[model samples]
Each structure stands twice: as structure tokens, then as C-alpha cells.
Target: MIKKIFLAIIILISLTNSVNASTTSNYAEPVQTISKTYTEGFYKFDNKNDVDIGVTLITNTPTKIMILDENMNVQFISLIPYNTKFYLRNIAPKKIIAIIGDGEVALSFDKI
Candidate 1:
């Protein structure tokens, strides 16, 4: 019947539209790794208040940089490729150090 053929065509069109929807437009989420090898002393701030902390990892592949609090909560996570920079702000005075992960270098800057 013509009605059956029309319905089949509609279904095929719907399926084709769904299949053609783009997948590459979405941005990649940040990745992270957890490690305890980096010491808290590396994030040291001279002035303590309103300091900016930056971490960088130099490698041939993509690296994840993460900072965790004492309770194991993620404070910061960054998806940085080799020779990229990741940063966080609002340095809490009470916390002395944070755990660094994924073999990244830590650099700290205090308020001027």
C-alpha cells in the first residue's frame, strides 16, 4: 500500500538523519592522573594570599595534572599536552601542600 511505503520512507529518513549527526564537534574533557610523589613544598607561596599556582609537564604525550585535598577531593584537573601549562588560584592559607599527579612541574606565584 502507499501508506506502508510512506511510513517506511519516513523511518529511513529519520534513521539517516540520526546516523549523520556529527560526533567530532564535541570538545574533549579534561583528563587527570593521581600521584603522591610530588611534595606539598613545591607549591609554596611566599605571600600566601591570592597566589596563582601553575603546573606544567613536558613529555611526548598528553598528560593529566591534578591536585587533591587531604580528603581526596579533586581541587583542580587539567588536560595538558607535552609542554602545556595548568593553573589554579585562591591559595588557601590553612592548607600547606597538595598532592600532584602525572609527573608535572609545579610553579607558584604570590600576590605582588
Candidate 2:
């Protein structure tokens, strides 16, 4: 009976470790980075990948960000504050635009 209990505990520990490993493996660093300074206009990013992606935006001044579809319809929009990191997940393969008022912005893209 003691031998059986020990075997069960070992199995449980192995299973737990495997689950943790798989989750950590899915995390990844940024694949692309774009930095730009704008006074008044827009910057576009084309996500050509078939799968959805993730986006992180860091700005030196308050800025507006938008995700647009193929037909130029806005899907998502937000105004991020200055000196902040904003993350957007599950962004479809489409166009992303950043509309700036007057400052610098840095953007990072990665696969989800």
C-alpha cells in the first residue's frame, strides 16, 4: 500500500510540472518593434499572419490607437495615457493604426 501511494504521488508531481512547462513555453518575446514620432497623422501596421496576434504600445504622450478591418471599419479604439504600457490581445490579422496628437510612440507585436 505504501508503494502504491508513493507511485501516485510521483505521477502527480510529474503531471503538474508538465502543465507548467507547456504554459510557459507558449509565452514569447516580441517578434517586431516599430517606433515613430508624429505631430498629427496616423501610422499603420499590417498583420499578415493567418493567426491572431498581440500588441503592446508605449507612448511618451497621450495617444489614440485603433484597430481597423479590411474595409477600413474600426474594430477597436482606445486613448492611452503618457508613459504607459498598453497591451491588446487576440487582435485579428488586419490593420492597426495609431493616431497621435504630438509625441513619440513605440509599438511591439508578437504572436499569441
Candidate 3:
């Protein structure tokens, strides 16, 4: 009786392993994909320039600021508080022709 029970257990385990082997062989495991993820309030800057960019905001003008493109065309204009840090939306510091504002600011750049 004990020998019969042992044989049945072995058969059950073998059957389970065979079923798992068939499944594993027939369907490959899901491949993990690598992708880029941007966090909230994170911005993607332009990184195709090879020159040192110096973005400086000159004070003693006005609260409203105007950012111009490389061709001197006005792209964006906004009001900024005095002596406060503000971010340029959808504008690359290096691509800007000029900034008309009131406050000293230094823009930093990083390679992506």
C-alpha cells in the first residue's frame, strides 16, 4: 500500500511538472520593456547646442518679462515678482535672444 501511495505521489508531481513545462515552452515569459519616465513638474530641455550659454536677467526695468527667440522675435512674456526664482516655460535658455525683466537671475543648464 505504501509503495502504491509513493508511486501515485511521484506521478502527480511528474504530471504537474510536465504541464508547467509545456506552458513555459509554448508561451515565452513577458518581456520587460525599458522606457523613459518624466516626473511631475519636470521639464525636458534642448540639448543640441555646443556653446556655453549665459542666461542673465537684468534688473531695474519692469516686473513684466519678455523672452525673445534667436531671431529677436518675441516668444513669451509674463509677470515675475521681484527677486524671485521663476522658470521659463517651453523655452530653452540658450535659444533665447534676450530677457526683458527686473531682477538678477542666472539660468543653469544640464545635459540630458
Model 2 — which ten-residue stretch has the worst lDDT?
25-34
User: Of the candidates shown, which would achieve the greatest TM-score relative to the real structure?
Assistant: 2
lDDT of 2 by residue, 1-112 (tens): 5575457445534643464356442212223333443343333444555334333334466555655554445566566567656666666654535353455555566666
Question: lDDT scores for all predictions?
Answer: 0.42, 0.49, 0.39
Deviating ranges (above 4 Å) for candidate 3 = 1-64, 92-94, 110-112
Writing each residue's lDDT as its tens digit, candidate 1 over 1-112 gives 5575457445534643454364631111121222212331113223434555555554444444444343324465455555666566765543233332344454544443
- Candidate that scores best on lDDT: 2
Q: What's the true lDDT of residue 12 in model 3?
A: 38
- Ten-residue segment with the worst summed lDDT in candidate 3? 33-42
Cα-based TM-score, every candidate: 0.40, 0.50, 0.34
Per-residue lDDT of model 3, residues 1-112, tens digit only: 5575457445534643464456553212221222222121112234454333333333544434444444334455454454455554444543432223334545544332
Give me the runs in candidate 1 sitting further than 4 Å from their true place.
Answer: 1-47, 94-106
lDDT, residue 34, model 3: 20
Model 2 vs. true fold: TM = 0.50
> Residue 4 CA error for candidate 3 (Å)?
99
Cα distance off (Å), candidate 1, residue 102: 5.5
Q: Local error of candidate 1 at 8, Å?
A: 48
